[model samples]
Target: MATELNTPQNRVRFGEFEFDCITRELKKSGRVMRLEPQPAKVLSVLVHKAGEIVTRQELIRTVWGADTFVDFDQGLNYAIRRIRAALEDDADAPRFLETVPKLGYRLIALISSSPNSELEDANHTASLPSTTLPRLYWVAIGASVLILVLFLAGPAIISEFRRPSPQIAEPVSSIAVLPLRNLSADPEQEYFSDGMTDELITDLAKSNKLRVTSHTSVERYKNTRVPLPEIAKQLGVDAIIEGTVMRSAGRVRITVQLIDSRSDQHLWADSYERDLNDILKLQDEVATQIASKIGSHIISPTDARMAVRDVSSNPNKQPIRPLNIEAHDAYLKGRYWWHRRGTEAETRGLQFFQRAVDLDPTYAPAWAGIADSYAVMAHHGGLQANEAMPKAETAALKALALDDSLAEAHASLALIKFSYYWDYATADEEFRRAIELDPNYATAHHWYSHYLVFAGRFEQALSEIQIARQLDPYSVSINTWSALIYYYQGQYERSAAQFRSTLELDPAFGPFVADDLARVYEQQENYPEAIKEHQLEWTAAGRPKDGELLRNAFLAGGPDGYWRRRVSLLKPVGRSGIGSALQLALVYSHMRDREQTLRWLEYAYQEHSPWINFMARDPEFAWLRTEPQFENLESRIGLLASGTR
Candidate 1:
């Protein structure tokens, strides 16, 4: 039935364009235009049903076919984009074709049958070689045309015609918003300026036309004396935004400039002063103006309307909901501490987020931040799973209840589902939904990659992590996690290279990096390097004495003796938490002591350790796959249902 709708037509015309369905060619203003096959097919379908909504499913079935093994959504979107580009049609103010959001596209231009439809036939025929015409005759014809043009227009006309027109500047496709300088007399107000910078990045990132670098990558440049071009080069962006934020009493002023990084030229600059309560409005105005100057298409009709609305008269036009000054301040502080990523910082961040929600109960972002903090604390072993996961889920649900469109909330909930509930299917769906809502949200991609790796989908995991790296290239966590994914996939050399690259970015992450590298080297059977890396990890963790003892044990006993020493040391600390018990199990597995490995694994299961989830894919446990006890443990933990490596 869908094939009937795709039946070839003789010709189709809309606006100044004509498409020859049989020849699969397109023309505008009597000149041929290059349209790729997929785009041309998509255009033909939209033209066939000019005024009706062509659903995405119909387009996929018609163009891609139901059985095609491709990413249907991404492929269809690319095809539609190509069609819009060829037509010079704006998705925001479409004149020829209009997108129907969740539905497919529609041809908005009026279509009519043209009497000159034979033009395509004539053009095709002319493109063929004329065997009957001699070479001399063709040369004479070309000479006559040149003489006629010179005789009619003169030499000056020829020179003028040959002159090139002034070139238009290319649209900025990528940008980095540097940390806003705090110009307040009090230095402690740095949090306010940092918060404002983050807000502007968030607002600009919503535009699908622009690839805005994540806040984590840009934060490193705060107070640095790096040249604008150098900073732009490091961030790998076409443009840079530099600003100064000043606050006095209940009023704030922000001065910002958009610079062309290659030329160091000011593309646009402006300053805004408003009451602190109107800060959200000011941020929206700045983002809208910058996007306009950079020629970024408004992402949606709602965004377009909000951008053009007279905010002075109708403040509700601002996309960001209004927040009380105190609540906003607290939320910003929370985010600052959250970015630090440590037990103390997380605890402090949680307190500030709670304060923010207390001040403004309806603030969805604050609730989302609360959920993020709780999820991180639980995930990093800073808090018990039972104590932290429930609170995280509740806060994430509340945030979604307030604003279902918050990608951060959705991502936070997805993390909870993946790590705590072990609901792989639901977690995968939530991660996809979050990414669909905001493709630029790097955290979603980063976390989703981990989920994929855990599910033994290494190729998909690599794909997602690559996107996250592009968005936040210098993120230490993302870089390290990318290595971790490779490690799980058994790509030891690649995992080592990635870990080394991550250490180059932030050497302070040495301990974590060393731990991962040690495991990778051990897997490669490079025991010496593995032992050295383990020592480095221990020293970085502030246990030089333990490092020395471990090194001595390795020297005296080799791999077996070293692992036995590790198991003995970890056994005493087993009462502290399930983590030590799991570590002992892992060491026992490495020593090839089936009895000891099974014993500690049973202890971990009895303790209800969250680390039990890793048993399915952790290569250390591969040797125990045939064991009945291991199968039973994995089955009970729900990993068997999800598949194992």
Candidate 2:
């Protein structure tokens, strides 16, 4: 019955426009205007029921048919936009068609059949132009000559039009993988989709030849309506990958498309379906296919063979082991919580990672997750360093033993070596190895920069941190640490600016960043601002009363009084870990109380504080550089003599 409305006699006219149902043509003031087939069909339907409402469901069923597998809401919106464009209609003050809100659309203008008198007038006007036969003969002769010239040059003209544009020919070296859409009927499967997107980003990052944006940067666009080109520009990538993941029963399906950001062209697209157990192979295949399409140099056949080699003796080999379905599920859940970046989330993530390892003890990636969660827990003060760092180190070592080429395990080990064991040389070596295995691992770059900062290699630290910033521009931790690097280099203004930017990304990082900013403010002699920032830090950490007391103490007796009060407050927690003791040492140093400072430094060293590695170069300890106690502490910790800078 809908097909009958697509006939010529059903022509309708409204507001100086005519829609021919038979010819499916839209003409404005007797001139045909271009409209896509879908938009024209939509227009025909709306005009047929002029002055009446047409629901979206009715239009969808009529225009797209019943079983269309697309994002219908987005498609319908796009079609309506096209209709408005073609009709020269304003959606806000619509004259021809009016949107009926959530229902659909309606033709607001009155419609009528085309008058026979107007048709006769149009025919008469057309006949008048044909009366000049002699002039028409001369025009025909001129057109014949033009046609001959065109015939001789047509191939060249056609070739010029058909040639690929510059953007199409340009190689895609960088890409951002947008969060994959979840197509499962159950909302609980969102974790699976997000995890798949993370895995794809990780897989792509393995290609040293391609600069893949980190998942942290791309996760911002999960449900965004922004266009692809705009997102690509923000990520500074040559291309973008958008996809959907659907998990049903024991089978999983993934559909992905690679787009050229500059040209908005689809360079390649494919769909893969496999059992849950084979999902790891599917991920590798998708990554390899995408790398090949982008002309990346890392997808050669030799690299594939190398990826499958034994990694025990060959440290250069890539880890390509498949994961069990149960292990993969637990790993996904672990990562889902891990990205939240809070103490509770870290603890929950650790449990999932443990479950993953328990399900498949050979899964190196799960072990890496366990290591990361434990390390983060320690860093966030959720666990004592002595209790957490050893467990993190054990998990990292086990992961490396299982798969020597696992970059994440190597990075975890590097962090443990630097912070727990104080093995600077071994930490540096592990960091280098992790980066060599996966150059695009932003976390490796982020942590390596910290190592360089402690080693007093400020220039190298700045360079490495900038690389991390480029890879994960939106990562709050990366941005905060970048600011810290600037602070360590005594660039107070730069540090302040970076902290402000990090806060802008997410105010929830206020507690962490405000503490760092407060330090920078204090170093710059901005006491009032430092106190204010410290108060903000305390308030964000759910201790407003402490902040108020500290503020009062600082205002009452200046820096010396502030340190005395801070030291007194920290004394209780100082026994919990080296972090609190190190904090006390810093406060004592600021107070110029060499005795208390040395006492806390001894305690920190005895507890294997990570900050102990920075003592030789820390500006706070500059006053104690020549002190015998400080010298003895440095020597005991094996500080390089050249670290005086």
Query: Highest TM-score: which candidate?
Result: 2
Candidate 1 C-alpha RMSD relative to the actual structure? 20.6
The alpha-carbon deviation from the true structure for residue 388 of candidate 2, after best TM-score superposition, in angstroms, is 1.3
Question: Where in model 1 is the C-alpha error above 4 Å?
Answer: 1-168, 297-322, 569-579, 599-611
Candidate 2's residue-wise lDDT over 1-645, tens digit each? 232433323455666787665445677887655454456657766765667799999788766555334445655676688688768889999998898877888888866555334452332222212223233224333433554465355531101001122235688888899999787767898889989998888888887589888987888888887888899888789998987787877877786767788776655555566678677767888888788777674432222311334446765755765547888899999998887777888889899999998988877788999999887777667777788899999999988776677788899999989877878889999999999988898999999998899888889998998888888888888998899888877788998998988888678778777877888887887877887887887777677887778778888988776777777766674535223878888888988889989998898887677667778766778889989888888877778543534
Report, for every candidate in turn, its global Cα lDDT versus the true structure: 0.74, 0.75
Clashing pairs in 1: none
Each model's Cα RMSD: 20.6, 10.9
The regions of model 2 sitting more than 4 angstroms off are: 1-169, 297-322, 504-508, 574-579, 641-645
- For residues 272-376, write the lDDT of model 1, one tens digit per residue: 666787777678778887888777743532232112223245545345445577888899999888877778999999999999989988777889999999888
